[model samples]
Target: MFVLHIALQGCLRGGEVVFGLTADTGGHIRYLLDLVAASSQDVGVDRIVVATRLFHGAPGPDYAVPEERISDKVELVRLASASPAYRSKEAMHAEVESFARNLVAWIAAQPRPPDLIHAHYADAASVAGLVADRLGIPFVFTAHSLGRVKAAMLGPAAAGCPDLARRIAAEEAALARASLVIASSRDEAEVQYAGYAAYEPGRIRVLPPGSDLARFAAAEPRPQVDAAIDRFLHDPGKPTLLALARPVARKNLGALVRAYGESPELQARANLVLMAGTREDIDALDGDMAGTMREILVLIDCYDLYGRVAYPKTHRPEDVPAIYAHARARGGLFVNPALNEPFGLTLLEASAAGLPLVATDSGGPNDIVETCGNGLLVDPRAPEAIAAACLRILDEPGLYAACVAGGARAAAAYDWDRHAARYHTLLRALLAPEPPLATPRQLLVCDIDNTLVGCAAALGIFRRWRSRQAGLAFGVATGRSFHSAMAILEQQESPRPQVMITSVGSEIHHLDANGVTYTADAAWRARVSADWDRDGVRAALADLDGLVPQGSLEQRGHKLSYFGDAATAQAVRARLVRAGRRANVIHSHGRYLDVLPVAASKGTAVDHVRARYGLPERAVFVAGDSGNDVEMLRAQGHAIIVANYSDDLASQAGLTHSYVARASHARGIIEGVGHFRRMLADAG
Candidate 1:
């Protein structure tokens, strides 16, 4: 079987193809190259193509090659975009449309199109989605980091990425259309894809990327790596806390610096080593890395941490193992304090080297810590948390030994050979022609806030139920904007929804592996936009006693939000009605008041979604707790209200076919499902 792997950014060169030759070319490049090398050894795979974008100048003339053979079975295919000069991935979004066209033309001219296309990162996913669609081949996506997730973490102050909306929309579109999504961790599969409406939990497969075990094994110690660290450290014998990553905002390097600076115990015990980039001059650096470097320097000077912190701007790729070996030799640990990690490849590298770890309790670390059992997970945002985790490993000899052993054991499963074997099996299965399974006709539409999450036991039980029950579908309806809802859903690790009723039902989205496709209600948008004077409304409500504007994320195209008590909400609603505004005002959780287009409501959205999917009344179950969910709960014949529901929801006691559950949160959902199933069983 022929497989096409697409990675569209970074400087591409042949010969050595060293993974960490520079900070800009990180784990993803290593992941692609290693996978190709391993797959070349797999007998089932006939040929491998590593398709990438071409850049002009800088790295070397080697990048100008149209195609270069890496081995008898593997080759690199470089496709150029519209512009000549190289730019960061964020700047390359606009050129992707042309890139896709060029790639498709190139493929069409080939002897035969690839059997399957696997795109890595957002840009590659975008381009690959279009190419795969045009050629009628299955498309797979591996989003190393999600744009929506990043935007949520950084907010409006985010730098470098100006076109967040375009990126997010592209991701959603790619997700919706892709045949399969390769997630490096379970957190990525379940949490990151939560907001998209067409997300099928079944389509995602959790396949962790592998490390080069041969390079990082515990037995191989490099003197050069030790020498490199010795040159930077005030005392080479001190227990070190090493952090290796690009100086990006999301990596949270500044926070790690602060954590080290704040803790006297940490400083007294271990030195902090950051291998950030290849530039020694801070001012010479540019873009996100420069900003990170500037902040790190300020913290260093402010904390008087000179001689205590070592940040080397350059390192050879072969030096990475020696770097890990140096830390291990010093009885030190590796720390990854990224705001959110998609997957921690370096954690595996460090673990394989018998180095103990202290990483953030975010994304990949959760799985890595669990599988490795060699580290402590803490909140990367908190300096105290980061410091505490590092201190534990540094101070306790018994704990340190256990972590080393655990890491070696865990590292075995993550070798490139095992990773390639798994992929070989998965691909062979996917390539085999089989009868299509029946789609789930019955759907459970539920609200996210205070209903689906916050009850761990029930959520676990629900996840088990979803796994066993193949014919049932699930979706989420919330007042949250798409991004906000996704942030919440990601933490729950629940099933991916087939539909999302976001922004108080002002927006509808159909999700697929290709990306999210918006189901536009143009007439609804026009009706709301026609006479809606947002500035006037803000001015009119500015002086209200208890009301405040909702956060930027809460404000949507046809929705204006405020946080206020019931009295203020009533006053705002009455005032808006008296002013003859075409709005539907909803008060939920006694604090959130949303003013939306009169044409939109959770109930209306449910009807629209139900009609589109052609689901029957008996097959749909709607669940909620707050007032915003009341319309949807009442709209469906099969409805549920949890025991902890607000008084506003309880007041709807007269609604037909509505069941009040004895359990709260996800437990309530389980009880509600049981109630509906019994009714259906009786009727049948």
Candidate 2:
């Protein structure tokens, strides 16, 4: 149906480039435009509207209208804020409350309000979250870059950018408030978003932003574009090293300059072409740009490289593909040396144009290199590493040829049409309301930790409430061992659950008044232990560098537990699988890893319990907070993710028939119980 997208601070549309530029008018703007353009082509999408903050006299001349039509199906609506024409996102951030209020007023006046709101970046998310709450519509967020991750990368320099703290707060609020968050890459979902407590891996869907292949497809370099390159090169025949991006401090342009200048082989073999945005005078640039420019200039002079490096004065968007083509024709290299790139859209463009790439080894480049199989990733902070990667591409003929071929082959998969279709599918599911079931026969299984025990009082309240309820049975599905689960139940003075799914679904136990006791499902246990070689698996993981064995109480016979981060967990999983053990590995909360039999999982254990009780499938409810709980959350039964669950769980994909509560612990249980009751009531 109808979708409202918010990109608060940017220059709104492609045509509005006539408006004086700001830091916000970059990749994000291009991303939204391409998304809307692609979605507009789909017959299923009724209308698409992009809402942005209106600007006045400061950045450029104020526009005459509040709305501008981009296409028959897509339109732009500019909502006026407290102040007009703020230059940067930092200024807009200060007035988000007013902007949100103004947007709400505008939406209230619409003949029919949009079905959903998708906010881009943290600033827009703050406004969208506020407005969406007020309007009772689902709010989605796409954090182009996260503040916590950026602050971590920037370190002490981050303090000088005073807005970082506020940005991190806004991001937390956004993550908590949004129905979903769109991540650009799996690394972004697993790494960048992992640090936030509210970040849910399930709620985050990684849909890489697509490149406009028609515009970026391989092409012959135009005469003017060729002349632009030839102007600085002593020999036009020499292969070139191309670097393109705005002159932002994080782009690490200075590092690239030094990288090329430090090595005699790189300097003598390939000319360095820096396209650091259109500039008439370097002295006229603002603070951030000016500082970066000074760094580049200092490096050039320090290395005594004058004519060897070409810093272009200006280039238009239409000239980009040809620029890549120019580099390709010369059999040159394309480099993106950003300190922390969110997603390298230009790498896609360069790949489509068949230019081999050498990018920084952080964020999106990791995915790009792995997927495209075309590039070498180097540490942007290390000049020698940068030089060495360039040399590898330049000096090795076989590697160069492979990179060129691989890039051409990989470029086709990042299609805008495919991305739009998937986006539409998710939105449509949210839009279509589910009919009420006949009764609340469904069983709701829940996880502990952040999911069920965040606030002590709420948990106590839920425990007292659960003890009194007789309509439904309950189960505990957690990564905790049976002993650990019993400790919490006993401490809380809570009623014993009918079933306990422990060790992250590796062990199943039935509970009663006597105490927690192991109750094996013979068939399920047989399936789990069929090919399991506990000793063999242990031996395989013994030499794994990062995996440290957990304490005795935390381990189980069927489940091998270890403490490790995301990368280590991945390595452990790979190693176990390669050793041919009949085990499945799960990494949860970014730290814990578990290896269980292929047939054993939280979902399967819950299913076994439901069958034992002879409960209808619809009557089953399962929940958890971290990565370990995702399989159960995605299972056929109704599910509840209690508020305060780890973000990794929320951002997980493919969750249906699940409810994420606003209240933490038992309050969350109470909230979910009420939701199910309402569903039953509506059916009657």
Candidate 3:
């Protein structure tokens, strides 16, 4: 499949990227390049075009080139925007309309339009969104760093910046328009994006970007790179505290300097090395980058930290790995005190180079440090916390050794090939003419816990049998939440389902074309929401005897769960009826009680799915084993009651026509399905 990547605010090109060359030219460029390179290796990916804005200015002549081939299947295509000069991310909004038009025109000229468009950052997403709308294509958004997150991190300082508001607006638009949002960490997906007006957790996926760290892992300290840093240090042999990032206030480099300067113990334990971008002249740098540099310098001088600190003016792109190696060789810690890091790519690189980290507790480092077990997380705003964390790692040899071993795991944990394969699968699903749910001739909805997964040997046989039925769409109608159901299915290595009716039919989620992510059914939610007063039902049944509220996980927006007996369930229904509130009260196993919307039940939900797919009653099959399954079993003509059924489900009213299988669990489901298919065959 052809994929187009749009990244409008960077000096994007192939080979030896000079990061820190432009304020906008940083980690996002590295991420995009690595992602595209990895994507090119996928057999399913036919062609990849990296689209960016063409400009001529200070960075270099390379940015002016309209097109440059990176590999056989990948090429960089730069489109001319309104302005020719380099534009920072803030300035990107002015050029969006022009870039979008040019991008669309460019695509129109291609041999075949790309199967999908992937937007990098907010500005690029805005441009891609417009291009997609015009071309009738779907685009996925990756907000490398969110404007709201940055604004929040900057706090009072962010208020002075007018462009930040516009950037946030563009991000909201991107979130609303994009088909999918790919996040690098749980922090990005859950916490950061949750603040947005267009936030939808269902559409946002956390797919960590893989880094090419082999070079860093095997890197040896070069004399040139070491000398650049060592010359500024009084004792070069001391463990180095390295902070490598663009010299921006958001990176919190000034805080790191203060942290190092305030503590004499930390100062003696490790030499501070600040590789804050390549600057020929500090004064020549623009805006925040220049101010940040001046602040670091002032802090260094204020605390009389001249001999102990190494703030290098410049280094080549190839020298990055060696810089990490230099720190690793000296038993140093890689520090990222960024106010908010979207994803800590440098943290991964440092770990791969055998340098343990002292990262900020704000963002992506939470996931990285947890996964790698290679570092300590400190509050970036607290200089004392930063100093203390550094001292702890430096003072303890055992902890240092543990971190080093953990650092070794980074290379395998974040791999590009694995990322590319998963990415390709998602794209392939997006390009599918129809989702698996849309065109299936028949659907088989089964209960998860008892009916589908109880017998491992029976499940294996069922899996093989299900795979052979080309026109059959399989799904689960579970009392469990979406996440809970998915967890069990994945653990059992069960066949991927096309539909999941979770939370006892209050929530419906359908599998996406990508086969990995699921989209919630809004129509079903709206249907169940009508006349359903959740708060009223709860208040009515609050003091009902023998009823106790279940834990938070069991409670859903449309479903209220309780640990109660059948008598309590009956009382709950009576209370709701007397209060004039409509709800469906379900009691199973003589113990668990679930209160759902009057329109929602396992049976009603099964009918909704059948009707949605335009399947006849004869074409829809449902199998269940207990009390909650009664509605579902009676709702369909092709119902299966497993031999290991509970709650007297087989003897339930209106279930007389339901098939009673001799076998149990998955074996029972298989037997009942065959019986129904034969009955249909005989009727025909």
Candidate 4:
């Protein structure tokens, strides 16, 4: 069983498999079903997501299978939406491109997320692998055929395949990042291994296609198949020969037909039955398989070998053993002459059916025939050699019997139970351990003006220009009321005052939920507004007429404040600066210059915000590009200086450590966040 090695100790949540499917016809659909069946035994795979896109004019949800059909062990997460355009040769590519975009978007929005995805081809695999990387999950790829092969075979049609190029690239990346690559045969590994980067030769193990030996072993001998065999017998009863596959040209069926036509002794004694799957479209014949099959049929008709050849309707793979048994009972040969096979799985099925075999001397077939010690191999293109091989097997009974015995013994290697076990081991190795999550208990106290957005005060230019800004301004973390301190703040410019000291140092109100929950600490703030003296420093220029006067004093929550009027406020501020008693002013709306309680700062509020969000204190950092942000800069765990930072602020604080990045504004923020994230990773 693929065990969960490192999981949230408290969160024993379920997981899903997003398996990509592009086609349902031919071996593609059966191959998917076989994998799902084998993976069901693993403990960690709780669901299977059939990641699909509609194609061939089929309506989907039509492409998606329901959760119930995938057994009780798997729930299906169908990620589908608006599809891309197709059919028009020039526009098929544009359509697929649109589909690829929608497909990628849908995959990213998955709610629970998949634990891993099994991509059937390089195209689907690359997209799935990219999402998995972003979300920290595993992605595996199974390219049934190499990209070079598909391109050569499909020609112009291959360019329209959306994920084709990305698939090739992503497969190589997934190889480096995946826990393991399930190579169906050593031959598949050898052919593809050199194409991938840093591909460990040992990691590519020889795990052939899965098989159900017991199921095939139990198939009952059928009379329907039996009767078809009887009519083909000649004066000297010859052995029967059956070949099953999609009649695609790559299956090399025309050569088999010609070979059967050329061998008179084998032809006289036996009949050759070739069954390629049926298709709904004569137009679909323009595709590779369709065109290939048509070429073979043309050759078959050209030879005028009609009496000895037979074509059967498509049968399910599970029922193929019955065909094998009926042919073998009459001493027939099960032949497979594929040109470039990837683990001749059907041959393994033939072995389970207890049939004698004749295969070609190429690719995966060589491994099967050589391992099983079954029948002879002849050149597929040469009819004389093919006919000669078939005759030799039939004429000598001992040779045919040896092939049957060898097939039965060779079938032992591909048991599903063992395949599942190996799969489990590979999965567990990849996820053996993970970091424990930290508790959510933190806050972020922050200064609003230059600290948040680069500004002289909280409110920006529009309010400043209207002469509606305050004076004796504050630029700190407190949410203190503007009304209490507006008169004093607006004294600097010709602005009439209505706001307060409530922005930075004192107020804490949710404008949306609870309005004005906290008040400005007015009395304490006033002490810092004037001169330093023995009598606790009364506003030294308080009654000075040349200086700015307090503005209209409104009720700020519960506190009363003395705000300077326009003239008195301006006079008071200028006179104080002359007296060497400058108020720690925060020039707010360019019109108002406000003063703040020296003790309060932007860094003070950062702690509050950080704690509310359950973030760690040590994890907090602050950055600002102004002299007004000195306190917060000192308060932060890490401080950064942008290229546009206040020269005074940068000089006081030496942040020129190598960790300091050479960026400004938005770019600086981006680089800073990335640097912090990398630090966390390295610490982990």
Between candidates 1 and 4, the one scoring higher on TM-score is 1
Tens digit of per-residue lDDT, candidate 4, span 482-536: 3222212222121221112234433332111111112223443443333423121
TM-score of 2: 0.68
Cα-based lDDT at residue 533, candidate 1 = 71
lDDT of 1 by residue, 1-684 (tens): 889988876766545554333334666787788788888998778888888777667555777788999999899988888886666666768778888998898888878788888888878888887886687878778878887788879776655556776778778887887777777775676676766665655556677788776678744557766666677668778988999988878889999999999999999999999987567566655457778888998999999998888887677776788888878878889999999898998898898888888897768787778777889988888999999989988778899988988888765666677677766655665666322213657878888878888787888887888677667767788997665565356445666566767888877655543232223444445644666677666666778788888744356657889998889888987787677666778888888898877777887787777776687888888889888987788788989888778856876655656898999988898898899899889989
The better-scoring model by TM-score among 1 and 2 is: 2
lDDT of each: 0.77, 0.77, 0.88, 0.50
Model 3: residues >4 Å from true position, as ranges?
156-160, 438-466, 469-496, 499-508, 512-517, 521-684
Structural similarity to truth (TM-score) of each candidate: 0.64, 0.68, 0.75, 0.53
- The C-alpha local distance difference test score for the whole of candidate 1 amounts to 0.77
Candidate 4 stretches greater than 4 Å from native: 1-24, 54-68, 81-112, 149-179, 195-203, 225-237, 280-286, 316-318, 378-382, 433-684
Model 3 clash tally? Answer: 1
lDDT tens digits by residue: candidate 2, 464-534: 88766666676788887554565455444455566667788877765422222234456666778888888
Find the 10 residues in a row with the least total lDDT in model 4. 3-12
Q: Which candidate leads the pack in TM-score?
A: 3
Candidate 2 residue spans exceeding 4 A from truth: 16-20, 62-65, 159-161, 433-684
* Candidate 3 lDDT tens digits, 331-448: 9999999998988999999999998899998778987888889999988999999999999999889998899899899998788887777677557766773456558899999999
